[model samples]
Target: MNKDIIYKDLDSLLNTLNLIQEEQTVIKRKLSGLLDHVVPNHFIDWAEEIHQQILNREVALQLLRKDIIALKKTIVQKKSIIYFVNNQYVKLIIKYKEQIAYLENEFKLWAKVTAEKFDTIVA
Candidate 1:
């Protein structure tokens, strides 16, 4: 019935489904052997058209793989930035809460350091 509890549950569920790690591994493996699976595009001087097509595809896949690798690097850097931001926010929130609690306590010893008690002199 509490919204905060619901939000926490949803956040946990979303965290379980994070695809960053899995996708990163898959992408690295694919990029590592991107050209390994394809048949060679060497010229045999027999079928020019078919060889040309194969070469064209090889070039396209190579180019696309490079682009994808670059994009992945960018995504990972951005993700790290986001993770850093989230960590800082969490730390700030905890510190702020602690400070508020300290201020709300029954005794404030810190006020003694920054303040002085003055009394009027009876002449």
Candidate 2:
């Protein structure tokens, strides 16, 4: 009975992770749409490029909000997975830890790059 509960809990957590990942994908599309709409004004100067980006500040802010929310969700999900794998998934052992670590590192790197771009745009 306890084993069944563990498996069910793990399964539910994984499903939640998948859903959040899908949400992240949609957020990415939204952010991409906003970026695509931004055309560079090469006729002017670098200052003009910044000005154009400023014109889209409202959309940028929205993207930032969505990005932050997704990021927080991802972090929480990762921590939950880590805790579960450490405590419950004994059969997976080494494989699960390595896979989970890889997933975390990849996500963190992606988030860092995204944040850098966002900071540049907002600044």
Candidate 3:
């Protein structure tokens, strides 16, 4: 892929990840509020569904955390600071960036899966 396209995709992905985090936060808060107020027995099933949604959100957050770690590792490796390090260190840094990018893409796939799960749960 073109470097420019890669960078643009990265930027858009980061923004989407940020929005997902925010939505997860809001869902957690709302779930807590719902739990505080006791509803009729008929609503228990809906509450359980919400609980599952919360769990899915938690899973998404975990995926996001992994992505963040990978992103940080990539950023560190791509920097010029490795020039001062030994040759092996420089090679390791380059390797790290490549590996992290692969892992980041995996996490992104998980994010998409979790998103679909969320939509199904919500629907």
Candidate 4:
């Protein structure tokens, strides 16, 4: 029963990570397209900054995935399940949630500007 709970929690975390990764991928592509346009220096700088954050987050996600895999192996072997209540794992989930929230707020501004710029070009 405890192992089942741990597996469910791990699955939930993995799903959340995957969703964040997909969103970041979309933002990365949008940033690349924006760079090709005649955007302002500050906008370019901000986009670059966000791009770097996305890259860093990607590394974090990879590491978390590896850890999850290891945890699963331990479960399969009927080893200790202390990893489930690990403070590091909890902290990571909180940190990821905060980062995603920040990115969403920042992306709203980026999207607004990009849409306005695109509209002007079309008109």
Candidate 1 C-alpha lDDT tens digits along 1-123: 233433353344333223322333343343234334433443122124433533453454344335434533443455334543465544543443353344324113422321221011111
Candidate 3 residue lDDT tens string, 1-123? 233443454455555555655665665565456556746564456667656865765576566556645654564466454432446544543554454455456545755664564455445
| Runs in model 2 lying further than 4 Å from the true structure | 12-16, 40-89
- The lDDT per prediction is 0.36, 0.47, 0.55, 0.67
What order do you get sorting by TM-score, best first? 4, 3, 2, 1
Residue-level lDDT tens digits of model 4 in 50-102: 77877787887787777666766666676566764577655654665575566
Model 1 pairs in collision: none
Q: Is candidate 1 or candidate 2 better by TM-score?
A: 2
Q: How close is candidate 2 to the true structure, as a TM-score?
A: 0.41
Q: How many Å off is the CA of 22 in candidate 4?
A: 0.7
- Spell out the clash pairs found in candidate 2: none
- TM-score of each predicted structure versus truth: 0.28, 0.41, 0.44, 0.61
Tell me the TM-score of model 1: 0.28
- Tell me, by TM-score, which candidate is best: 4
Ten-residue stretch with the least lDDT total in model 2 = 42-51
Best by lDDT: 4
RMSD (Å) of each candidate, 1 decimal: 30.4, 12.7, 7.8, 4.9
- Runs in model 4 deviating more than 4 A are 79-123
Return the lDDT, model 2, position 9.
Answer: 43
